[model samples]
Target: MRRSTGHPRVRWSRRGAAGLVVLLALALLAGCAAGPSQRPPVAVRGELLPAAPPPPAAQAPADPDRLPEAEPLRSGPPFADCTDDVLAGLAAAGTPVPEGRTLRIGCGRLTVPADRNRPDLGPARLGLTKVTAPGAPADLPALVVLGDTGVDGSARAAARLAAQLPDPVLQRYQVIGMDRRGTGEDLLDCAPADARAALLDAGPERGDEAAMSALLERSRSIVQDCYLLLGGQLTSFKAAGSADDVEALRTTLGLARLNLIGVGDGADAAAGWVAGHPGAVGRVVLDGPGDPTLDEPARTEAVTAAAESAFDAFAGACATGPDCPLGPDPRASVRRLVDRLSGTALPVGDGDSLTAGATLRAVRTLLSQPSRWPELQTALAQADAGDGAGLARLLAPLGGPQGRFDAALATRCNDSRVRATPGEAAARAADWDERFPLFGVAAAQDLVACGPWPSGGQVAPATPQGSALPPVLVLGTAQDPRAPQSGAERTAEQLGNGRLVRWEGAGTGAYPRTPCVNAVVGRALLEGRAPAEPVVCPP
Candidate 1:
């Protein structure tokens, strides 16, 4: 993926601390009943039920128990003292380190048994990277950044953030990036490539029993293969199990408190962290948030609708701009493109082509960032002219590209529960198609791919436990097509000391890059100041 171009240039102010504090305080007072709950229509109709309750919270596991224990925060003398050691290692690897910067980072492999559910099995070596900050304060916070699909970007992002942090803040903490259970260097050799290919071939349009059965078989094969490859080491790799992995990493690093930085499915892991290790968590910043507890069909529908809505917004904007390449009526142009693209396959590039399924996938990716709307509009215009090159370019990682589809599919399937039978999946997909006419058919098919996966894992119900920790900042873009603004508001209400900071635009919370939002989070973390008023960011 291309590096995010342009530094965030928004102004910052320390004066906003008091206001943030007040706002957070009020939000905490309002509590869970303060916000509206948009229950799914299916829930109201008794067609679905909530997930089962999670395991009871207790002390960290003290033995080689079946279940993994909670991870601890890393602590010791300031990381600066060890910088030379870290830098030398990086130098050996030919990785660049700025002058005057010591690479106080360490790499280690932890041998935790394959499956926590079966602790008697031999251990698997999980890879971990730790960076220490020099002169860290005695009471400074420690952060654990969770890796998403590919471990590369997250590792780089964490290292860069550590390097950029103020010395004082750096001295107060260390950052640790842990590869999830089955990804990165810890990837299992037995992972079936064919299973992944099978699911991908099923396409995003398959909503029938035959297609779903094929998808399920692939999912089941992957799970069994993973287990066998790991020597029956892990039965399943779910978010809850991954949370345990995080805790283990914390203990190894000697951290006293955890500040979880989660992205995408990592957000689910963060929530699992809070639920499993409540008091030990210092803070949480969940980017690209998703509700894991939502029923499969409901969550799929929500995401698909959000994508369509975002596309409509972009089209509307393009139609109003005279410079827009999609003629004077971009909205109509978008609809036309959608109609033509849906269920239609067109050559995209030298070897790749735009299938109906891939088109929606591209649209979903573009909707993730509002700033890219103009680019997407232009790409649509180009596609309208029968040249799919622009659209193909936009499909790249930075624009809308994805990593190995097989990996993503495998990871997602392992992380969630799926339908039991092809028949059931088909029926559900058909129902969803009617309900979400725009994106439902594809969404349903996407979920069906998991039907054949292992039937059981450690599934956790959504139990929002209010934190006694300091007030935490939660940000949500009003037009976020992935994690809806409403979910952010719901999360704020659920947390005891929470504040909803709103950025009224699309995509995940743009706080890290936005000086204003970052300032708020930084002050909150440093001074325990809550936002006094809702931060309603303007378009």
Candidate 2:
């Protein structure tokens, strides 16, 4: 249930750049230098771990049973109909409604029943952004980009990509970005002014059960209060309901064929969209993949292993540094630090001190990006010197600059259905500590926090069937800390016409930055061609 840290916006120093080059060289040698005769295809085996049991059957379904089926909504002339209200809203939002253009972009609000099954009830105004391509064709291709963490950013990225394509490509495509149900501009603002203060004051004390329960109760109360203040306009939020929304948008947009691009948990929505829509979809792109079907134990195991591997790579690099930032033995240094932070409380400046919770937060942040390993090395060194300021700086962002942790919790809790019985949760943490000896314990606790969430969504039906859709280029970084490189390989293998493109260094694929990678991806998307062999980036 850990959220990925935002992509870092910092530039690499010359030394860091050189290090990256060397890392990439090593990765290329590890992955590609072997001849075809020497390299054999790997077959992954083992059944997925069993999923956690569904919430007690007594709880209401996260979403209603059925949604309204309506004619695909359209804008005017070039479109089927033009609604003035939709037009007005666009103008109000400063979105241009182009005139006499072959393609028309429209903005509108759709009122969906808070619960899909109850259409007779009042509706919530969910914002929609639509782009219509112009061409005489019976069935046009459409894609819905689901935002990974932020709706606004996703919409912008979708629009940017849509604009960059050729006129013919544009004419044959339609892209829409839905604000989902409860986030972005659609977030319910009914919580009283003091709700934030109340939640902050309810922080858990020493991981005590009583204190944690109090915190959960306070969070529930805040959400309930907000729901009531909104006049029941918004109910509980879940990914399944969001999937239904995608279907509704597809129908409303009038596209005969659909495609979906899902990033992070948004990938779950894409899978569900395909599952629910069936033959209606032409293709799918699951960036930063996470299987919606993975049960709690499997996901916990997968992420834990990925984290350990990434950390080990970082430790290896640190050990090679002349100064030996942490110590002569970087691996042992990490283990000792983790052990020290687990139990003892360290004094902090201004009367604040490092606790187990703070330590977990620091580890989570560091594990999110392998590229930041050097920074983590520096932070750990500072902590070893008896100043916890570096660690605190790393942990501060989890709550966000405004200190709102609820948003992160809400998104993660609604996305996955993993939980631990209080006893099991505690035991799992201890087990993780014994197994990983560095990262497993904190990850287990984070996964456990989602167990008691009231709204748990359905797992998307697993359809390992590959799409006959055009060849889609897939990219993976060997050292990505959050989304492991193996995930990219799995996704590519699952894709009917996918080609795995491997990059050796850290972070996610360098699509927006690396010209070489982008050129290859552009070829795949624009010309329906994939490289014959993996593109090896030189150091």
TM for every model, in the order presented, reads 0.66, 0.58
Best by TM-score: 1
RMSD of 1: 16.2
Q: Summarize candidate 2's per-residue lDDT along 1-539 as a digit string, tens digits.
A: 11123312111111111223335433433421211211112221111111332112122112221111211224311222223434443343233345543444544444444555644333444544456554434244455667544322244334433544445445645665566555433543333234333332221222344444444455555555433333222333556766766665555545444456665455555656655454455344555555343567666667667667767667777788777688778777756665576555566655455554565455545654444567678877877777777776665444322222444455556666655554565566666667866556555555555554554554454443432233344566555455566666665555444456666655432343355665665554444355766565431
Pairing residues by index, what is the TM-score of model 1? 0.66
- Cα deviation of 350 in candidate 1 (Å)? 7.0
- Ten contiguous residues minimizing lDDT sum, candidate 2: 9-18
Poorest stretch of ten by lDDT in candidate 1: 8-17
Across residues 1-539, which tens digit of lDDT does each residue of candidate 1 receive? 11122312111110111233334433443421222211111111111111332223343333211122223343322122334444443343223465676535655444444465554453554444557654443344566677455322344335544655555445655676666655534443233444543443344457788877777677677656544334333344556766776666555445445666665555556666665566555556655555444556566666666666666677667777778888876656755765676546567544455555555555666666555677777777778778777666655432231233433455566665545467766887788667655556666666766665554342342444553343445676666666566556655555544466776666644545466666766665554455766676665
